[model samples]
Target: MENHLYDGLIRYIIKKTRLDKGLQQRDLADLHISDGTISNVERGKVVVRDDTFNYLLNKLGLDGGKLNELVKKEKEFIEHLKFRLDCIESMLNNGYLELANEELKLIHLDEFHPLAPFLMYLKGRYIYKKKE
Candidate 1:
């Protein structure tokens, strides 16, 4: 069968639920999946089966309107992160290291932050590129 288009909406729903429940990726994986599978789902590269999705939603204590709102917020956050990354990249390329650093600091303060390490690595690379 042709693969379904990867859905950021679904991915975000899972992410928010996981974070709300304080479950790490490994912890969720141990419930009946592999860590790699969870990673793929979070990245929106794979579609999970309906039964598995329902199990996750139930486990996370999400249903009805609350679940819908979680998915909506996830999409919003994902879009915001994309925009923030773009802005950070532009600032770095324009020699605005201080601004980029400030944004990175903000991200570090978020509980479910994912890109802080990657952003730091990019900052190091930016410095190196400038020296070359």
Candidate 2:
């Protein structure tokens, strides 16, 4: 599960960076790898060796260390988001509807995000409380 999460996150980062830099997958190709492999990596459909992964990042001009730093920060932010959601849940359980709603307003996560279902569940709970 953890490995899948890492792969997905890496895929997002690579694709976003490549698009942002206006580079096509073929642009990353060299003698060591093909554009199809690059596409597979961006889609999280295949795992490559560490050297190959680093090579792809190098092609995007993103240093491996810098990518690691971005990953660390992303993980930290996700942890913080989970903590906030827990707090919102606790607020709802304790009948702090306004506070939970306020916290919900502060959060803006993509529906495809891993924790989005939890957020949706909380929203349902909040609505139930209102109906009561």
Candidate 3:
């Protein structure tokens, strides 16, 4: 589910930051944290509570406020991209080839993007319509 995806993303970020700082899971220990909790969190075998997650972030010397802001912006950006893809699909379905092509031009999604296949489908529809 989307919640799992968010958890995965957050855990991955934490793991990456720890590694980038040349710290191992054991190095992130807190007085209240038991052995292996950090490792389990990094591996995502267990879900970390917000307080524990914030503690881990603090141990890494990361600014939790900034990280939260980045996550918020990323969510908003994804929503906007989804909206654009929907508009592109509607344009293609309505036989508005010129408008569809123009809208497609504005989207620069990565080749491996989750929506890439849908974008390709829309482009194919535009191409097929042109040959009609």
Name the best candidate (by lDDT). Answer: 2
TM-score order of candidates, top first: 2, 1, 3
Q: Which portions of model 3 miss their true places by more than 4 Å?
A: 1-67
- What TM-score against the true fold does each predicted structure earn? 0.57, 0.63, 0.49
Worst 10 residues of 3 by lDDT: 1-10
lDDT per residue for candidate 1 within 11-99, as digits (tens), equals 55667668767888787665566777777767766777766555555666766567677657766776788688778888888888777
In candidate 1 the C-alpha lDDT for residue 70 amounts to 68
Error of 2 at 40 (Å): 4.4
RMSD for each of the candidates: 5.0, 4.4, 6.9
lDDT for each candidate structure: 0.66, 0.79, 0.71
Candidate 2: tens digits of C-alpha lDDT, residues 20-101: 7888888878899899989878777777777787778888877867777777877788799899999999999999998899
Over 1-87, each residue of candidate 3 has an lDDT whose tens digit, in order, gives 122323644565566677779988877786856448787776678776767766777787766665666557656776888898888
Off by over 4 Å in 1: 1-5, 23-48, 109-125, 130-132
